[model samples]
Target: MRQLLKFELYKIYRQKSIYILFGVLMLIISLGLYMDRESEQANYLVYKQWEGEITADKLAYLDKEIIEIEKKMESGIETPQERLLYGISESFAYQLGNAHKHEKRIADLTAIINTDSTSYKERAAELEKNMLSKINMSKFYYDAGPAQIIDMIYTFGFVITAFLIIIGIAPILSNEYSSGMDQFLLSSKYGRSKAITSKIIASVIFTLSVITGWVALNTAVSVYTYGFHGWKAPLQSMFQHYFAPYPITLGEAYPIMISMHLLAALGFTLIVICVSAICKRGLLSLLVSGFIFGVPFAIDVVFEDLENIVWLNKLLKLSIYQCMKVKEQFVDFSTYNVFGFPVLYPVVTVLLSVITAIIFSYLTKWIMKRKQVTI
Candidate 1:
């Protein structure tokens, strides 16, 4: 078994497709890092610059700074520093206003969760309870760097996983027949269970390695380039403003979101291998995976109104694209009930991945067992 596993791994890693996948993933990491840097400079650099010594107690600090700039303008002249400050006054004001608005939202949500816990029906009540668990209800300092960038990188990182898995693992079963190796493979003494098991194991390792390397490289490079200053900050401080109610910080959300994506990739790999086993054609498997993964975004673009259909929307949201989007997991207006308990979207995504992986694994095993030496 160990020898067979090593042989399978050797074959997968020896393939030129693996190197191509790595090159593409590294390219994405480079591009995403560059974009995050540019985005930070354009969007949040001003807010971060003006956030000096500001806090909940110093909520009026930005207002005072604005006043100082206004008083300087009263002199009917401006220096370069004053001109810069004046130009950025509205943006600075907006960040301050956003901070105050965030505090208000936290307070309101906390009150509703505590006082009105029982005022709703099944899903809503479950959602409230779930939200309550996440609400820390404490005043937090504003952090204006990296949160938005990290969110963008985490999501964009999904593309690497999905694309690379297709290229690397789509041939797990398909190429055996394509190269006329299926007959010799299945008729061997260790053919039946051992061959299928080794293939499955090989695909699992390859998919996980690609996902991990992509995430680790993306996060490491981005954080190193941008500096990890915002990990301790509240999620609400993010540009999305959608995840504000969740009590998790960027630090907590980062791993959880990445885990969801990794599990999603696993689920995708399993299904693709199953398709490969059935069709025994790598290119066809790639197309099928592409269609399955791409369908959600296509729906979102082509039929925006279809999301309004409750069951259909919930079903669509389970796809790898929807599940990979951490922002939508929290902010999107969808709730799923599991065993009568309302599970958060991200949690639901992970659970669905696990379920899908299990079911597909069984189906793949059955298919392989029933597979004849058809070359």
Candidate 2:
């Protein structure tokens, strides 16, 4: 088994296409980082001066400074220094304004729960619970880097991993059959079980490696751009997560988000392997796997405005796209009613991924065994 696994890993990693895809991915990431226009250094310095617990005294001082800056701007002579200060002031005010915005979000959800049909009442209640939990979020910190990294993981990272898996791992089993190696393999002593088992394990390792690679690159680039600050900042300090109900800091949420993404990607890799086994042709397997993986994203783009249609929207939320784009599961506060109790979307997504992996594992084994017998 160990020998077979080693050979499988070698075959996977030896492919030039894998390295090429990684090169492309890295180039795109570098381009994105280079093109970013924000003066993160200046922003960081300004935010650092006001970091920590946001208190009334700080707000008052900021209000006075903002008023003074506005008066300077109102005078027909404004210097670049004044403009920069004004921009910083407004940014701080906007960050603080998120508190009021979050409160309004909670009140809106509460009102919907009170007036909506009983069918949606449970979901609304869950949203209310989540919102209320973070209602007291008062701390502020320089979290721009962490926020960008988190957002990049859910958006670009998942897409990159999916394509890499398709280009690399999707051909694992199908190429064996295509090249007529299946006959010799099936006739070997350990081929029927150990060889195929090794392939499955190898697929998982490749998936995780791809995910880890992108995650590390994202973190390094973001940290280099924005500095290693805000690990202790509350998750809500990020504009994207202003409504997030979790009480954890960016340091805590980072692991949870990556873990969820890893599980989802593993589950997806298994399904792609299963398809590769069934199709018996490399290109066909790639096409089918891509379709299955991409359909959810297409649906989301088409029906984005129909989220008010609860059933359809909830069904879409269960798709792999939602699992891959995992940030929404945290920020949006969605839930599933299981056995008359509300289960958060993140929990449900994790459970679904695990279940998919288990089911597909057996199915892949069964398919391989049946194919061997026929051959």
Q: Best candidate per lDDT, number?
A: 2
- lDDT (tens digit, per residue) of candidate 2 on 1-375: 999999999988998998998989889877876634357786667677767777788878877777777787788467665675666566566656866776676777777777877755647575565756555456667777887788887768888888888888888888988898887667768867777789989989988889888888888888888888888877776767766676678888888998998888888888998998888899999999999878877877787586788887777788877787787788856667776667777899999989988888889888887874333
lDDT of each: 0.68, 0.79
RMSD of 1: 4.6
Candidate 1: residue 18 Cα off by (Å):
3.5
Residue-level lDDT of model 1, residues 1-375, one tens digit each, is: 888899889878888977876887688657745645565444445445654433544446545666777777899666655655564555444545655655565566566666664444344544554554554423333344356455654466667777777778778788988998888777878867898888889989998898777667766766655556656665655667443446677777777777777787788888888888887688988888788778776786687687579787767777767765545776633455556555566667788889988989889889878877664
Give candidate 2 regions above 4 Å deviation: 35-39, 71-88, 101-127, 134-136, 308-311, 373-375
TM-score of 1: 0.80
Worst 10 residues of 1 by lDDT: 136-145
